[model samples]
Every structure is written in structure tokens, then in C-alpha cells.
Target: MTDSNQISVDPNTRGNANLIYILYLVAIVVGITSIVGLVMAYLAKGQGDALLENHYNNQINIFWKGLLYSVVSVILIPILGLGILTGLAALVWYIVRCVKGMQALSAGQPVENPGSWLF
Candidate 1:
């Protein structure tokens, strides 16, 4: 019997998934680079590629949240070094998790990232 819960996902697509995750990691390192990749990935969604769309959407959400939060923290520096410290810590953790998530994707598996909290 065919299980309705089964979804069609190619194991070989791990490489593609890895590519997307790498964008998130890079966003941590280069900042702007990740943002550009996120935008490009988002635009690629309308090309009729559902899997890629989902992948890019995940990366985009992560990129924007990290980027925005980091900027906000910097602005709050006047309140003391707490904001900056927390922001940097969170940013570092985000990058590490992004790398781990990429490894998961590269193995044709799923990962739980902060962005995944949305849905």
C-alpha cells in the first residue's frame, strides 16, 4: 500500500540542500553575501521548483532574522555592552547551527533551525 504520508524527495538533492545551507552560514561570516544569496534563492522560487523554494525560503528567513537582530543589538549598545555581547553570541551560535544544518541537508536529512520555528 502506498503511504500518503510519503513525500517524493531525491536523496541526491542533498547537494542542492547543502548549497542553500551554506548561504546561511556565509551570511554569518560575510553578512551581505548571505543576504544576496538569500534574495537570489528567494527569486528562484517562482521558477516552479518547490523543493528549492522551500529551501531558499528557510535560508531567507534565517538570514533576515539574524541580520536584523544583529543590527538591532548594535544600536542598543548605548544601553551597555550586554546587547552587543548577546548579539555576537547569538550570531556565532547561528553560524555554527547553520553549518550543522548544512551537514544534515548534505546527508539528505532534515534539520531544526531557528527559522523552522515559524511553521
Candidate 2:
């Protein structure tokens, strides 16, 4: 029997949360879609169960971290001429985080450390 205190996540909510990764992927092409995804993630965060909540937190971190990396990359563009490489590394990091989150969500599991900066 399921414990009364055990939280159960809705499958539909899980699917919707998974869509955030897709939005992150799409953001590669549209650029603005990540913003939309971030907004959606923030809105839905409050409604999630433990697992979904972890996914939301991971997604939110990905967005903010990516933004911070991008800003740093831009600032370094002229001074160090390393912005291109840094930007690409940031993009790869974002993709990896999204992919990893989606994989964990698909397995009906919470990420080991949602707030972690590394994948």
C-alpha cells in the first residue's frame, strides 16, 4: 500500500515538465523560447510533487546559469577573444543539463542533485 504521506507525481505534469527540455532545445533556434520555458517552469514549479519539483529547480538553474555564462562570454569577447569558445561551452552545458534532466524525469526519478552546476 502506498504511504499516505508519500507524494505522488501526476504523469501529465511529468510530461509537461519534460517539455521544458524541448523548449530549451528549441531555444537554440528561436533564442527567445528559453525565456518562455523559464517562465512556464516558474509558474508550474509550485504545483509539482517532489520529483517534478526537482526537475523545475534544475530547469530554472539551467536558465539562470546559461544566462550568466552568456553575459560573461560577451564581456570577454573583445578583451580575451575567448568569448566564442566560452559561449559554445555554455551552450553545450545547457544542452547536457536539459538532456540529463529529461532522462531522469523519464525514469520517474528525481535528479541526484538538482541544484548542482555540473551535469
Candidate 3:
């Protein structure tokens, strides 16, 4: 009996994706793991099934977008005095994105919008 909702994700792909998500989460404290995860995502891109590929794309986008937000927030620190708030928002945003990615990956589903700027 086959379950139509069951998804068979490749073990290697799932493992790598899971690790990348964890690294992103740990990066909040360690700060270096995010870079490692970014590299992993780049290397793993286009090397998996469609669902895994979507996750890789989402992870890559998260890195670049997070960097942009961080930079913009820093730049606004002295100019507008809102940098701190923006920075905090960026951190929350990053965490949410990672959590969402992990959830989707666990369900064997592609990210809803891999390139979305907001969760």
C-alpha cells in the first residue's frame, strides 16, 4: 500500500539540509556556523531532488539577504538611531526563516517562497 502523501527524500540530502538549518540556528550564538552553512548550500545547490534544491536555494537567499539587512542596519545606527531595532528585527527574521526551512524540509516539501524577503 502506497500513501500518496508520503515523500521519499534522499537520506543524504535530508541530512545535509538538516545540518545546514542547525548551523544557521547555532550561528546566532557562535556567528561562524552561518558561513559554513552558506558554503554548504552553495556546494549542494542543484545536486538534489526538487524539494532539496528548493531548500538549498532558500538557504542561500537567507544568507545573502541577512547580510544585506545586517549591513543596512549598521549603517543606519549613527544616522537614524534605528539600527539597533532593525538589527534585532533582522535577527528575528533570520531565526524565523531557518525555523520555517527546517519545518518544510522535515515535511519533505519545497519552501513556499525561497526568495521571499519576509517570512
Candidate 4:
């Protein structure tokens, strides 16, 4: 149900969409950026949801976990030799995953096929 006063998305009202887009871009730099997008999207429910909040959150979770594991692997690489690849791989993979998630969300879709992601 909708109310008479709610501000829905119009092609003309590109402001909020712009904000969401900027936030999504920010996510690429630090996956945690999705948090800002999520909050903004939720707060703008009356203006229609950013529709990417959940996807952003999921991506953030996966990103941070991947980052943590990558950090650990990097720290262990000197002792474990050849393990540095794992950290680099994890970082690359997560970046790809987060990018995909943000893309899907921006398209007003849920990021369903992240491929074996834990969160």
C-alpha cells in the first residue's frame, strides 16, 4: 500500500538515484561503503527504496570476511611461501563479487548469484 504523500521515484527526481549511484561507486573503494548507502536508502523509504540495501549489506559482509582472510594469508605468506597468492586472490575475488552485487542492486535487483559466498 502507498500513501498519497509518499514521494515515489520519477525519472525527473534523479537526486536520490544519484546518491545511490555514488554510494555504490564508493563501495568499490571500501566495501564498507555499502553501509552508508544502506542507511540512506532505508531512510528514503518514502521516496522508494534504493532497492540495493540488502545486496549492499551482503556484499559488505562477504567483502570484509574476504579481506580478513586475505590479511591473514598475507601475514602468513613469508612463513608459508606461495601463500600470498591466496590473499591476492581473495581480494580480487571479493572486489569482483562486491562490484557485481552493487551492479545488481543498482539495477533494482537482488544479488542472487555471487557464487559460493558465505554471507
What are the clash counts of all predictions, listed in order? 0, 0, 0, 0
Instruction: Output the better candidate (2/3) by TM-score.
Output: 3
User: How accurate locally, in lDDT, is each candidate?
Assistant: 0.60, 0.85, 0.90, 0.57
lDDT of 2 by residue, 3-119 (tens): 876533443388678778888889999999899889888888878788888889889999999999899999889976899888899889988988898999999988788787777
Model 2, which residues run further than 4 Å from truth?
1-12
lDDT of 3 by residue, 5-86 (tens): 6643443469788889899999999999999999988888878888889999999999999999999999999966899999
Count residue pairs with overlapping backbones in model 2: 0
State in Å the error of residue 108, model 1.
0.6
Whichever of 1 and 2 has more TM-score, that candidate is 2
lDDT of 1 by residue, 76-111 (tens): 788877787868776776676567566655664555
Compared with the true structure, model 4 gives a TM-score of: 0.50
Q: Pick the candidate with the highest lDDT.
A: 3
Sort by lDDT, top down from the best: 3, 2, 1, 4
Better of 3 and 4 by TM-score: 3
* Residue 94 of model 1, lDDT score: 65
